[model samples]
Target: MEFSSNIKKLVMLVNVTNSPTESEAAEDAHQAMLNISIPQTLKYSGVRTQSGTDIECSANETILCDLGNPFKSDQKASLIIIFETSGITLFTEQITSQLQLSTISEQTDLLPVPVTLNVKNTVLTMFSLEKQVMDTSFSGSVIGESAMNSTRDVGSPLEFVFRVQVLGEPLGDLGRLVIDFEWPFAVSNGKWLLYLTEIVIRGQSESHCVPPGKIVNYLNLTLSKEGTKRNKREVESVYPHAEASVTVLTTRKVPQFLDCWRQTALCQSFSCPLSNMSTQVEVRVRARLWNSTLLEDYAKALRVEVKGKATLRLLTDKPAIKMENHTREFTVNVDPVLGEEKPYEVPLWIIIVAAVAGILLLGIISLILWKCGFFRRASRREMYEAKSQKAEIKIQPSETERLTEEF
Candidate 1:
C-alpha cells in the first residue's frame, strides 16, 4: 500500500455543491502489528499506549489504527477509500527493557518472551474520531525492558509472540475497530536492552588435547539467528569475536627445530634441557607463516651480511632447559644437558673391524718371517764375504815373499 504520513493532514478546503447522503455499507479496516521479543524478559506495561505508522508499507495501506472506529479521512482518502485493502502485512519492531534470567529456564541458547494487545473500535459520530484519527507511528526501540523473575522455567523453545495490549496480563476489547490479542513469550540474557534484535549465537565447537608438545588451537562453529532475524552480514558487521582472532595452546614449550637436539626430537629423544630453552622459540617454529624477513634473506642467500638473533632461551615452569632453531652462529654454552638417558648409542663397527684387522696383520708378519728364513740372507752374505777376504790376504802375502827372495 502506498502509505504517507504528513500528506494525510487535510489542511486545504475544497468547494462542494451539496452534502451527499451517507451509505450504510459498514466498511471496515483491520490492522495487525509485527513483533520483536526479548528472551528472559517480560514486555513492559507501558508499551500499549505507544504510537506509530506504516513506515514500510505502500500508499494503498490504510493508516494503522489501534482497533478503533474509522477515525478520519483526508482529501487523499479518495484513492485509499476505494481500493479493497487486502493481502497480509507484517509488522516488526525492537523492544528495549531489562531482562530476567532467573525466571527463564536455564538454557545454553536464547529464550523468547511473550506480549499482548487489545485493539478497540466502536461506531461514533464525526466528532468521536477527531481525538485520534490514526494511531501515531512510534520509532523502533520505543518499548523498554524491565525486571523479570527467572525462578520458574519449564522445557520449551521460549517461543511466544506479542501485540498492542498489556504484556503478561489479560487484554480487553478497545472502544474502536480493533481486535484484542495476547502473546506469550520467554527471554534470556543479551548485551543490549532485551536485545531488540534476535540473539546471534556464534561459537566454536568443543575440543580436547593430550599431554606434552604442540599447540591445540582451532575451532569450527555455526551462527544462528535465534528468536528473530539477526546476523553478521548486516546485523553485526562491527562486532568483536570476528576473524581478527586466533587461539593458542601449549602443554609444553615446543623445542626449536633448528637446534642440534630438537632437530632429532621428532624422530628420537635427545639430551636438551627444556627448562632454559627460549619460550619464544615456539614463535620461531610457528613463524613459518610470518616468514621472518631476515631468515628469508638468508634463505635466498640474497646478501652475505644480515644482522639477526637466531635463538633466545625461554625459561618455563618445567625442570629442563633447552631451545631450538638457534642460528648456527648463536651457540649456547650451557652445561652438557642430559636426558634421563644419553642417546642410547651404538658402537661404530668400523673401529671394531680395524682392531681385528690389526691383530691379523701382526700374526701375518710373524708367519712371513718364520717362513722366509729369518737371518738366512745375512748368514749367506757373511760366508761369501769371509771366503773372498781369506783369498785376497793369502795372494798379497805370497807376492811380498817372492819379491823379498828375488832381492
Candidate 2:
C-alpha cells in the first residue's frame, strides 16, 4: 500500500517479511533507506536541513524541525524539498516528494505623523496717534479742528510673544526653524513703518538633544522689506496718498524645539523698535521646522508650516476748544502787586505808538530850549552901540591928560 500525507513532522515506516523456505542464516539482512534535499533559502533556526545536499534517513524514523519566517516586508521567495527512497522494496520502485515553500507575510512600513500648530495670544502693548489741527473761527473765538489724523508711533522696547505646540510624533533634533513676520499694510499710503530690534526663542526640554558635532534647537530668522513695486493708482489714492513699502522682521538664530513625542514646545519673543504707522496694519506670522541632520535641502521634505495673524490699532486723545455766545460783565477792585505781569509778545501797533511818542517828546524839548536863548546869536545894533561908548571914554581920558600938561 502507498500513502502520502501532510504533517509538521515526517515519519516513514517499512515492514519486510521473509518466507519460511529461507531457513537458518541463509537470508541476508534487508535494509531500507531514504534521501532528502531541501532548498537553501528555507534554512531557518532549529532546522537541520542543508540546501542542495542529500540527507540520509532510515525507514521508521521521524524528523522534526521548526519553520520560521525570514523574509522582509513584501518579499517573495520559494522553498523546494525533494526526497528519494531506495535500498528495499517488494518490487523495483523509486519514491520522490517535492514541496514548495513561500513567505507571504510582511512587516508594515513607518510613516510620518502629522503635527498641529496653534496661535495663543496677541497683545498690543503700545499705541499712539498723529493729528494735525486747523484753527477755525467760532463765535468770534478761534477753535482748533482736526485736519488729518492717523496712528503714529508705537512705544519702543515692545515685545510680541508667540507660543508653539506639537501635536504628533516627537520630531527629532531639528536643524532649523524659521519664523517670518510680514506687515500687510507696510506698503500702504501714509508711509507706515515697523521696526524690529531683537528676537528670542525657547525650546522644550526633549528637543535639547544635539547630535555629535552638531547643535540642535537653533533658529534662523531674517528681517527685510518686500521688493518695491510701483502702484500709480495707490499713489493717487486720497486716503493713503502714496505707496509705501512692506516691512519684514526676522530673528537671529535662536534655539528652539518642538517635542512632538512629548507634545511640547517653547515660546518665542520678539523685541521691536518704536513702530509707526498711519493706517490699520495687518501682521502675518509664519513658522517653519526643519530636521537637524538634514539642514536646508531636506527641509522641504520634512518640514512643518504654521501661520498666525495680528492687527494693531492706534488710539488718540485730543483736547476740544469752544467759545460761548453769551457773556457776563463784572466790576472788580484790585490791589497792585510788587511783581509786574509781562506779556509774552508785544503788539506791532503798540511798538509803533511808543516810537512816535518818543520822537514828539524830543522835538518839544528842543523848541523850549531855543525860546530860552540857549542857542541864540548876537544882534548887529547892539554890537555898534558898544563900540561907540568905548571910543568916547578913550577921548575923555586923552583931553584930561592935555589940560594937566598946559597948567
Candidate 3:
C-alpha cells in the first residue's frame, strides 16, 4: 500500500483463502464494501478506476466501492482511493495519518475478532500555497486637510485623509488598516482630548459619510500642516471613478490603542468575496486641535511637525493567498495656533544694542588698520614720485655722502 503527499492515493491489498474453480466463478463473484471518512478540511473527489469507468457519488456521503470479481484465491488484488482538499488548509506543518483495516465474519466457525491492518505515513508531508494561483497588490497614502481656514489653528476643523487601493485580480475577503500617529494626536498619559469628528469612506462605486455623532468620542487628531490640503486635493483629482467597489468599513466605531502612539485601526469585511476586481478605499477623518498645549513648544510661528504612517493588510480564508505588510509614511508641518498677522518689526532695545555693537566693531577695525599704517597710505601720484626720488638717489651719490668722502 502506498500514500504520498503529491498524490492522495490509498491502496489496499487483500488475499483470498478459499477460491473456486473458473467454471463456478460465475455463480459466486467476489464483492467488498468499504467506508471512507475524511476530515472537514478535505473534500472527497471521485475514485480512479483501472477500466476507465465513471463512478457517481455524493459529496457529503461516504464513498462505497464495489469491486466485482477482481479477487482470486492465492492471487494479489489492489484497491485505489483518491481524495482532494476542500476550501483551504491553514496548517503548513507536517501531519500524520493512519489507515486501519478490520474484518468481520458472520459464520460461527470463523473467528469472532476481525483482522486488522495499520498503514502509517512515514515520509514528510509538505503543504504549501504556491499551487494556488492568485494575483493581488496593496498600496495607500495619508494626508492632512483643513476645512475652516487655509491656516491650521486651534478648534479649526482638520482632516487626515487616507487613500488605499487593492489592485490586480483575486483580492482578499477581509481588510485591515492601521495608522500610527505622533505626539499631536496622542499624549504620554494616554489621554485623548482631540476628537475624531467624522469618517468618510469613498470608493469607485460608492461613497459614505459618518458624522461626529455616530463616531466614538475618544479618538485623537494628528498634527497637520498648511501644504497637506494641496496634496489631499491632488489625490481627489486623480481618484478613480467606477460603478463597482468593495466596502471595507462595517463598524461605526474605530478602535484606538496607545501602543502605536495612539494608533487607530479599522477592520471590516468586503461587501463581496475578493475576486479578480480592483478595489479602492478612501477614508477622510475630521479632527481638531482641541489640546492647545500640544503646540506650546513652538515659538513665533505656531508650527509643529506631525508624522503618521499607515499599514494595509489583505486577508482571505486561505492563509496562503495573503498580502504582505504594506506600510507608508506621511510627515507634515502643522500650525495649531492662528498665524501671526502683524508684520514683524525689530524691537527698540534690540535696535539700540545692534547699533552700539556695530559702532564698537567698526572702531576696533579702524584702530587695527591705523596701527598697520593703512590711514597713512599715500596717493598713487605721491607714491610714484617717492619711487622716482629713491631711484635717482640710488643712481647718484647723496651730497652729505660726497662731503664725507672728500674729508
Candidate 4:
C-alpha cells in the first residue's frame, strides 16, 4: 500500500511578484524560480507572460472566444490578458526574501493535453497568466485555480510560469508572505469540468539567496488541482452561464468624472487632476451567457461585466487614497438586448400595507358620510341642530380659543 508513478498531483499557486527589499542581498530573478513547484513533483513552475506587460506579445496562451462560446473545441480556454509592470533587481537574500521567479521561458500551450483516463475531468476557471514585474501594482487572479466539477491526476507534473519584479527599496513593516494557490490539473478528459481560481501579490521573502546570500526569486510558478466537479449540465438547463471580458478604457478620473453632457457637455468640463492624468483600471463583472449551459457554466468563471469607474482620489497627495466603490450591474437574458441594473426603490410590503390602510380608512369615511346624508337631504331637526352647533362654536368655541382671541 504505497504511492505509484501513475499518481496525479494537485497544487495551489499564488504568483508573488515585484517585491521591495530593505537589504543588499534582498532578492534576484533566478532565485525566485526555485520556489514555485509541485513540492511533491518538484516541477519547475514560472510564468513569463506575467512579468512584462508589453515586453513581448502574441503570447502562447490562446483564448478561443466563439463570440458566444468561449471554450470552443478549437480553443479550450478563454483569453486572459495580463499586464504587470515591475522594477526587477537581479539579487538574492534569505527568508521568503523577494518571491522567487522562474527563469525558464513560457512554452505557451493554450490547448490542454487531452487524456482519456477515468480520473475526474478538468475545466478552465480562473485563466489569466500575468503579474506585475516588481513593487508596482497591476492585476492578477486571487485563487491559484478554482474549479467547479473536477479533480487532479494525483502525481502529474504541472509547470507554471509567472513574472517577478524586485523592488530596490526597503520594505517597512510587511515581510514573509505566502501566496496560497490551488492547482487544478487532471489526467483524464472525463474528469475535466469547468473553471479555476487564484490570488497573487507583490511580495518579498527572507529565505531566497545565492552565494553572497542566496538566490531570491521574485516570481513564482504554482501548481494546483482539486479532485472534484461541482455540477453536471444538460441541454435545457434554464440558461447556460457565460462571461465576456469587455475591458472598458477611459481617460476620466474619479471625484472629477464625466457628467453626461452628451454632445455638448462632452467638451465642456474636464477639471483638475483628471485634466493631465491618464489612468486605467479593470472592472471585472458578470454578464449573461449566450450558448450551451455546459459551456456557459465554464465561461461564468470569466463572465464579468465591463463598467467604467476610475478614481479621483489621486487628485490629492494622500499616501494611499481609498477608491469609492464605483460599481455597475448588467443582466443579459434570452432577449438579444442586455439590461442594466439601476438603483431602484422597490415597493416594500410595509409601504403597500400602509397604502392599503389609508385607502380603507378613506373608504370607511366615505361610506359613513354617504349613508349619513352627506349627498342626500338632511332632516329639519338635524339642520337646525347643525346651525345651532355652528353658532355656538362661532360665538365662543373653547377656553383655548378664547385665550387665543384675547391675546
Per lDDT, the best of the predicted structures is 3
Give the true-structure RMSD of model 1. Answer: 31.4
* Model 3 spans with C-alpha error above 4 angstroms: 1-29, 33-44, 49-64, 68-184, 189-195, 201-228, 231-283, 288-295, 298-347, 356-407
lDDT of 3 by residue, 1-407 (tens): 22223344333332223344565432233442344544443456655544433333343555555433433244333444555533222232222233322233221222222323222222221111111111111111112233223223333345566665543322334333332322234444533324444445555444444323334233333334422233444333322122222222212222123223434312121221112323555555555533333322222333344444444454444433344454454443443212221124456787789999999999999999999998986689998999899888745789999999999
Instruction: List the RMSD of every prediction in angstroms.
Output: 31.4, 31.1, 15.9, 33.1
- The residue-by-residue lDDT of candidate 4 on 182-253, one tens digit each, is 111111222211112221222232121111211111112232332222123421132232333332222212
Candidate 3 global CA lDDT score:
0.38
Q: List TM-scores for all candidates, in order.
A: 0.16, 0.19, 0.34, 0.16
The lDDT, on a scale of 0 to 1, for candidate 1 is: 0.21
**Model 2 steric clash pairs:** 170-261, 174-292, 175-291, 175-292, 187-244, 217-256, 222-250, 223-250
In candidate 1, position 33 carries an lDDT of 18
- Estimate every model's Cα lDDT from 0 to 1: 0.21, 0.26, 0.38, 0.24
Backbone steric clashes in candidate 4, count: 99
Model 1 worst lDDT window (10 residues): 281-290
Candidate with the larger lDDT of 3 and 4: 3
Best by TM-score, which number?
Answer: 3
Clashes of 2: 8
